[model samples]
Target: MNKIIWLFPFVLSTLYVSAQKKTDRKTLSNLQMHVAYLASDKLEGRRTGTPGEQLAAAYIAGQMKDIGLTPMGEEGFLQTFTVKEGREPAADTKMSIGDQILTPGTQFIPLPFSAASSAKGEVIPNVNEPDNIWLVNVSEMDITNPHESMANQYLKEAKEAQQAGATAVVFYNSKETAAEVAEWLDQNPAPIPVPAVWVNDAVSKKLMADDAEGFKINLQVAFKPTKRTGTNVIGYIDNKAEKTIILGAHYDHLGYGEDHNGLGTATKEIYNGADDNASGTAALLEIARLLKASKLRGNNYAIVAFSGEELGLFGSKYFTEHSQIALSQANFMINMDMVGRLTAEKGLQIGGIGTSPAWNTILPAVAPKELKLSYDSAGVGPSDHTSFYRKNIPVLFFFTGTHSDYHKPTDDAGKLNYDGALSVVKLVYDIIDKANGMDKLTFSKTREPQMGTNARFSVTLGIMPDYTFDKGGVRIDGVTDGRPASKAGMAAGDVIVQMGSLPVTNLEAYMQALGTFKKGDQTDVKVKRGNAEKVFQVQF
Candidate 1:
């Protein structure tokens, strides 16, 4: 009896130590095997609903099975669905107004979903005014992103135009607006809205003159909406029925655009989303592998790789609302996005930290002391995780900050910082294993989202900023005019240097300072209007 009792303690200790080793920090390098394959050129850009995406899904499913993870859905590992492709304008279309043959890009741009319909109205005699005009009104359907999609500058502009009764937009290539728009396009080449057309300086001058005649516009513009299938590869650990833990990442990226620019060879411009997602997806697979290998189960854990995140968070949104799994059963969400760019200069950024008090206690302990971590409570931001937050699910999104490579064709597996990802994945596994072992976490009714400091305000700031901005911040995006910042003279091209009295050197600091004042509070703000810094303030 004495020997058995002694052995009992030793046996329990051995089991505990073995379980710990299953998810310890050193085992993350295992991601190398999975990430290399998933992010390889063989997967292409893994655009949602493409053969590449399906192949990735299959690989992930097979890995999950090999690691011994159970299938979560009825149809095996994939929680498959479809998304309506954005309206793509004809690439080689022609547009001309009166005497001017507008430049394809500079003078006129077609709406993505402008419909297969073409418009050729007599230049609304604006030509008699100095320029002939073709007023192409991009229909709301072709222009407006589905309400379920995350709102950005285009959506804000659409809302404003709708409110202003601005039926058509006239884009003129004067010295100013043309240059401004050119810079805008370099950063963002996504779909644009409008019954819009552009005019050259000479054309504008004619319109401005009294000799402009009855105008005529000939347009061969075309927009068509098609449906494409996207996949959400899922594998899970069946555990307690209580609250489930959702771990997700987006697996698609920019698809083929241009052809080979070298010699006589034809090379596809495939944007393999290695760091953009293959890294995160690989982490998910490795975590699933570890969990499966351990054969330890507790809270339900859903491991999913989402598609359509590049176009929008369509795959994630669809899965969150209409899932083979129950939403309420979800306790919280952890999203790993853009995690392959870890560096010593700029460490990790943890979002949604303030949403749940649990993170306050846990993340600090789980994060490594050697690295710097920035946390925020805005439980919502511009990512797939936002979809879950809107549904009231507390969420955490992990990012290693943005670089020039993000969304660019250069973002490939070759540029991924393997060691950096290894550190992050190890940290994540610690958190996941801890969350898996806990009884559902408690939540506070109100969360003060943090960017850098503890300044909490009751007001909401509306803007979808470019992810790469940090210090002397650049605003590549803006919200509707009636919103707080817009009403305060904040424009898209303006670089914000100071929000209030605080130096706005980084995103966290700016957010923290913004929290100091509430919706009704008015404050002074500084921005670079052009080459000069301008001071402006307004009542929120």
Candidate 2:
């Protein structure tokens, strides 16, 4: 998730500035050089699991090696993880009714939950004969219930057919209806026992036209699993201390806007996320250099360049779960993201202030007078810092704010504020230095904020949707107090399966369900908690 901070203007007292320091020429040059290469078109926006992301990881590793930081990853400085990149139809996937061959993607399409096997038998329309293909017609089904899922309906029908010893199940609509078969094609569900497929309206009409007699059908539903590997670069300055401080930044960006997460999705343009994260990664590199050469050795330092942050904090989450370093010895974590576009006001947004009491004292003392800082007390937000906060660790997230060029091709290296970024690096270093004298900071739980305010919807469930959940439905990461979700007893980790009369299949479906309601509306929200499904009455 992107760090979409909703800025509220605030400033620190000028008394905090004890002295003014000159900007180092070498630091500025290094920041610019790092951003220039990482955000350049040559890196293709450094999308995770791509060659571009690998190149960026290699470069960060090289920089860490040059700084003399000890490699801390499972493989030298690289920690790799596998990501499920959806699925694709195999070459053998085909369907035919006697001599009439049907196209795979157009005339007929296999659902993601279809069994990867072949089935052949005689088919009779609207017949549930044993050892025969079942042709289920959904033309007369009551699909008007908003809470009902067409995909689920198809799966239920297929399951019933399989129970009757059917060879396979095929779904189609004989008449015009609002329901679409294509909508069920992309859903991720558990595979059924037998092959299942959906045919387009043209093929459906052809099948129903010949329902008077049985026909031999040959069907195959085969899919190849699509996957990619994301790598995290880890380097440690082992001061031989009892505690370790972590510094992290994500280097992945939207590659040619292929993931549909970018602002400019209509064009095949490389979304060079300079301000989005390249700037933060550059700052991390410079910070590693400073810490490696610093005399403050009260705590060990772990510098990490994470990937797949734009894809729901995959890299950081993976590291925290499968860390080589002792997490129990972790002091705190500082995350830098989108720290390149500092305004003339020197505005900087810092989150997770409420995560630790030490931040309340250390931040104001070490902050420079030139910088106008706004703070969010929430320990959970749309960034990698939230991952650490979840583990009962203190966290701080630094960001300059969003811009018009955010998540677009226009966000290039030339637009970065090198001097401003360098200042941010210095401020982080100062905070670390001030905290060197203290013991590990105490962790505190704070309220989680909503992801963002979307203009498309007027009402909100007041929950942060977990973006990493791919199994189906929208999983709640956090629930805001005094909101609809909280009032209805919705808690974090609860997967919302239905909203009112609408079935919530995915994040987009959940958002659409939100748009259907208004203030003062009351509805029943169904969520899956553990092995049980519960319904809560919510008033919006």
Candidate 3:
């Protein structure tokens, strides 16, 4: 420990070190209090752009100010942005559909970012009649090899039928249908450029029956697209601007869906996102408190809590890209996503190990061998860190693997494994300390092949699967993001029911059709939802 100097601030580094023992417990307790409130149910999973999220931002900013960290942006401690999504008035409104009294709330919801309007449209290419192709959900896995999945086959069939000019694509719900459907609807609901609506068992049968004459649908929905604010809560201790270490976490999760595990309505249950991200946010605050007490004052470390991670890492992406200072100020970005739980009570998954050469070298020096640091050769995965990685920044994402509770209401704080989280945080803290003192540790990308399953594959398809399509054959609510579907002049409202000679019924079927072809494969993908039956070529 260094000695104190006369009349100098923080000159007594020795005083800070010995005092660490006396302050550890109290500091940790304070951190726990802040995290507890941030992760509470009142925040509604801290969904981006929601009222609950706004409340969370206020709470976090207050905590940051209390810690004396400078605001990193013009908007106080908040880095704000808007995320577009589909939503409709709760299925409780009343309206008129031809002679029948059309109900507003439950039958349809406004698509995310759909134009605000009062819509009245007739059922074109009516699928309720016999002979119209309909989409249905199925479950057929390659159990013989768990590593290999044929999930895309379902989507392939739907694309084929849409090309055939199928009148409608009715869909069947899956085991995770409720949550997935809500997500689908939130991203892409019906009735923008084209007309589409979701139907339950009774409504679907009623519309399909011939007796359902004078069948007209009327809807009044409102959509707003002005601007919104979000935040990434951060606190720092800067003692003369040194190299930095970032302890970061995303404080967002998938909000409540249409149904909660098929047991209760989405409104009744909350997707607490406890493990999904609440756990990560909690750790960030705790680490700040720890370092503050330890007087680890040389480095300019930031403990950040990010928002909008569920809706595609919006908040973290903003902070890293639009920093007040240079992005290179920090040596490493250590992120914790779902570190509250451990699989088999034996290991934690550490992706990005293969992404950086330095990770492979330094991991052994700081982390336990038995704890098992896992990795994907590709440093990039579907998380907030991907934004940084794409920018050629060295990054690490900590995950505890996925579970049944992922993206579901069951992801509650009551289920969090605190001991597991503590262990992981301790391990990460050590890693940062080791890296902080190193002289210019250079990081290189590791382009390793993926091992087991491929969630997405690059194939020629000019259709977008709209979760809000509410039809069969892997409902097409929108076109693939930045794919041939978008380039071939396809729009979000267009649903693809068929591809080439195959019908895309579900994600599984869609995968199977794509599997039959190699790269540079071109084919006619058919999208027929909401009276628009057209075929487009998807070139590989």
Look at candidate 3 and tell me the lDDT of residue 91: 39
Q: Pick the candidate with the highest lDDT.
A: 2
- lDDT string for model 2 (429-538, tens) is 99999999998999999976333555245466777665446578988866766778888899988999998889998776787788778656899999999999999999
Q: Write the per-residue lDDT of candidate 1 for residues 204-224, one digit (tens) a residue.
A: 665555665555666665543
Error of 2 at 84 (Å): 3.5
State the weakest 10-residue window (summed lDDT) of model 3: 257-266
Question: Which candidate would rank higher by TM-score, 2 or 3?
Answer: 2
- For model 2 the TM-score comes to 0.70
For residues 1-540, what per-residue lDDT tens digits would candidate 3 score against the true structure? Answer: 234445355545667766754455554455346456766778876766777777877877787777677776557777776555445444333334467664433443333422344445454323433334333333321234333322333234344444565433333333322333334444432333322233344455555466755445565545432444566776666756556766678886655542222112245666667777777777776676566655555567777778877767788788777776556776667788887766554267777776567877788888876576555445666677777776666778888765546666677766777767776767777777666566544566756324236544534453434322224665543344455666676675565577789987755567677766644567887876477688888766
Candidate 2, residue 163: lDDT: 89
lDDT at residue 230 of model 3 (Cα atoms): 68
Any runs in candidate 1 off by more than 4 Å, and if so which?
1-30, 85-225, 257-268, 445-495, 498-540
TM-score of 3: 0.62
